[model samples]
Target chain A: MTRPALAQLVAVLVRPAAARELSLADWDLLVRVARVASLEGRLQATIEDAGMLPDVPPAPRRHLHAARVLADRQHAMVRWEVARIHEALAPEAIPVMLLKGAAYVMAGLPSAPGRQFSDVDILVPQARIQEAEQHLFVQGWVCEGYDAYDQRYYRQWMHELPPLTHMRRKSVLDVHHTILPPTARLHPDPALLWKAAVPLDGFPGMYVPGPADMVLHSATHLFHDGELENGLRDLADLDALLRHFAADDPHFWEHLTARSFEMDLARPLYYALRYGNELLQIPVPDSAFRALAVARPASPLRGLMDGLFRRGLKPHHWSCDGRLSGAARWLLYVRSHYLRMPLHLLAPHLMRKAIKDHRKAKREKSEP
Target chain B: MIAHEDLKARLRDAGLAIQVGPFVVRLRSQLDRIERSVALFYDRQLLPVDGAPFADFHVTLARSSGLRTVWRPQARFFLDGRSPFRPLPLAHAYPLFEWGLNWCIAQHAHDYLMVHAAVLERDGRALVMPGEPGSGKSTLTAALALSGWRLLSDEFALLSLETGKLVALPRPVSLKNAAIDLIRERHPRAIIGPASHDTSKGTVAHLKPPDSSIDRMHQQAGPAWLVFPRFSAGGSDRLQPLDRAEALLKLVGSSFNYSVVGGAGFEAAANLIEQSECLTLEYADLDASLGLLNAVAGGPA
Candidate 1:
């Protein structure tokens, strides 16, 4: 099959030098796809890192530059907010482990530059989660107006509290006690993660997960995520993290595989490795795959999941989608909820969401 | 460049790629009002889609689909297949397109430090008038463009971050409410489009940019003066010098992406203020305002 524009974007991301050969028309499509996937900044960073920005056509170069400027500004704001968050919780002595994007940025990881973030995610010990919330409340971060039912859902079943918005700055913060919901099928013990967390430089109370745990957390977050609008961007993060970590440590993959099994996150790691290798062509050791064999789904289910994820992982743009792409995304959304909670709880939650969405569409359509 | 009929056909089918100063926009619409608006306001900017291999923004102004099409029909604006705004009444299609295009530029064009202002150039120096709504900035811009100055833009002042120069993006000069008849009466030769009533901005029309302005849209000018214009009914025309510090703050406040661009935005705004004469103009009469502005531009009063 001929590579679609999305495949070309993936190729350019994997090998930034490939961008030199793209036609103006190709850049047009690539820019649209990358923007929709939220990977434009990442693409810009990779190309700039490769020192091939001058090789890009002027028309497309402006877009890359614009995205970079926005990302750089956001990175600065995130640093400031993280510092404020550290200050808020320092008195309580809460172990604030920066998760995902904030972690990548604070720790100065390869994936840090050019990543866009909507909120900061931090993990704390489950016992002190309320103490962390109380401290944040004193610092002027209030939970947004979620209805009673929604609040109950988050506080009871979800891993993170309802997102808190800073009154003055309007920035969002998500404080999680664990990587996954307490009720999730895959329970990665928070204790192991906390033990392995490393303190960020110049930040006494703040920490970032170690290299193996970081990769596992990213993989778990992506595979278990319900929304796939940024699926490709999240996968690129996994690819970047794996590539950087594996290259930095010779025995990285071995340690990651062992840790995934220990944390009961072997399945997400398997999917992350498979998709990263297949989609972006990130090099993965064959032994890693063999080690994850016990965590793979049954043959038929594996085939089905492959079909869904293959369609779901591309940019969520019309040009990148096939006939069943919509269905694949919907099925994965259901699968994500199922992974997060048991069927009894999942059914009601999805039904409520569907009803609310239907009402919203109706209201919009009826408006003049 | 393509003929009018070809532009309409392409707009109804694929899209019509038009050069709008520093950006290429692909506009697709089936509405007759949109076609007429483009013909009237952007006659010189249309480029053949095949020749223009890329577009910075792809927008569509279409009549709302389904039951709304028959009852209280609405026109929706979509940029790259996603609507950034709720649909307006079908009669307001042209204004919707204009507003949507402005949003596209303000949201994405971070390469330039954009301010909510009208800009015109005279003798290689730009006059930047930053104004809030009901401040008569657009009316003043229409007057200036009609007089002789090259219109840079009627809505945005795109300050290039790289050169610290004002880039021209001269499109239609939108005249709201009473300003519509005021311009038509003052400048009889000005080509103004049919007015759309009951818009969110109340009774809006567009004045076609002069051929001279569109012809030299690529020209970039250095900042010469920053004027904050306010319209006061029956008030005498007055121009007062504004402190550079206050001018910088107001300019930053009027900017669309000043905070997003951060330090560079501050530097660019400061440099523009530092190099230009900053003033506040409050006037009632168009002719008086024009004369005062001309004097500020160092031209005939």
Candidate 2:
């Protein structure tokens, strides 16, 4: 590649915030780095056919080095946060399951730092959130102001707890609560989550989502929430699972299907796998997608119509509403209200919520 | 009514114990572990510049997740109920604590300003970066940290309105693909861990805070400079001063709870923005950024 071309390639790979261009040399370097084989020759093979990396030297050592740096940082954050959680929940002694990133770190992957974690996800018994909060308070964690109405709406009606803020550290923790908000229409209780949780190797009180459940949750989070952008990573997670866990257990697929059905996340799982296989070359069985109704809508025209509205249409009935035009906007507002409370109690709930919020806003304004 | 003894029994059932500075908090019958962390343990949540409580309030809380299910905020603790749904995973607890606390203050205190940014110091001056994810905030923070700046925290840089001291809680520096490699090559001895791929955010790697940074973890620094650093793959390093108002707006936007703290948080943010020289930095090369930072870090007060 020429200097300008290489620079452009560098720009694409590095994504530096300021400069929008890369030199030819930069592109050559990036191409070399992309071809490195730290992961069983995966990178080498992945980039082999791409013209960008043709005849390039082995990928740079910086890739592994970068992975190590991220791993360390993530580990520190996870460990410190875990310890802090331990400190916060000392009273209830309810065992906290180190979900997602925490589990990833505890299982050992220090080179995989900067895993783009938005929040530290964890699962505690529903009975223990308040107890959990009390423990955190003494440790310099504070709660952001929400009117009593909003608080009640969330506490009484929502799935997880409202987000929590650490007073001194200021790191945000989303003290969830139930994976699915209580108000969710989905069937089945969250208590089953504990049944599927397996303890971490050395951490006595902590656990991880079972292999099957982990895949299911990832799919649900990705598809249920319109996670189209991070599809690559989400699929990568499943691939990582196949590579890491499938070898140990032959019943993985059966368990995965059973759990997906039990949790009502089968469709999402099927699509994740199907797209993953198509996009990233994850080799999931065709039978899986065939078993589920993931045929991308029988009518292509109908599918397009459905896709337009279903994707960004109204946010409330996002699951069921197929038509694009009508009370969609109003439905979303209504949905937020319902999300804030059950339908029958919507009117009174809104009244109470409004009063509470007014008072909170007043108080905050008056005090500081 | 559930007596104090009953509450104690419920707490015992849950099995919780916590130590905050010099206090040992035991939650026997309480539903809120975090409330006690602030109220019962600390006479006041915010310490003034003189190290005294900022206000007459003991503590406050605000929650958004469990309203319909766990809204029973009685002093009477119920430890026997099983949630109908799976609780959030434990990995989320720390961020939850931070967010919950923000709600409490934003809804209740209305007396402070909160800015979303990370604060680090070297030679007594603090570098504040306020940006969203994918903005290269964490990447820049890690690069600067490995280059010899004291990392206050990659996630938060807490400024106690009362004490005028920036609280240092050195945590992990999250890095993405290329930045991860850059840091590793830059600091071969750095400690890193497995990268969790395909998260809602993206591929993420966490870098352990440098041991030296952690060693000076408790040492607080005053606000010095607030610079929002953006990494451009191969862009030249540039740093330009920003006005207090614009800088404050940028910093507040990065804050997890600026509106909640209301004036106090705003004042705190405003004070820092005014006291510091604010700048926006865009760099492609760590070396170039490091050179720029070294000059800035070493320059006269």
- Residue-by-residue lDDT tens digits, candidate 1, A257-318: 99999999999999989988898897899999999999999999999999999999888888
What is the DockQ score of candidate 2, to 2 decimals? Answer: 0.02
B195 in model 1: Cα distance from truth in Å? 0.9
Compute the interface RMSD for each candidate structure. 0.9, 23.6
lDDT of 1 at B194: 96
Candidate 1 clashes between residue pairs 3 or more apart in a chain or in different chains: none
Give Cα-based local distance difference scores for all models.
0.90, 0.54
Q: How would the docking of model 1 be graded?
A: medium
- Top DockQ hit: 1
Q: In candidate 2, what are the lDDT values of residues A1-368, reduced to their tens digit?
A: 22232223223322323122333334333433222211212222223323333333222222322233333444566677777876667446677776665766666532133343435777788788788777777787666877576687678876666777777767767766666666544443567778888887755677777777777777666555343333334555566665556676876776777778787677667756755564445666555655665434466743553444333322121122245534443443454455434567778877876787798789964652
lDDT of 1 by residue, B1-301 (tens): 5577887899988798888999999999999999988887787888856778888998999888887479788899998888988888999999998889899998889989999999999999999999999999999999899989999999899999989999999889999999999999988999999999999889999999899999999989999999999989989999999988999999999999998898889889999999999999997988898899998777898
Report the number of the highest-lDDT candidate: 1
Candidate 1: stretches off by over 4 Å: A1-3, A358-368
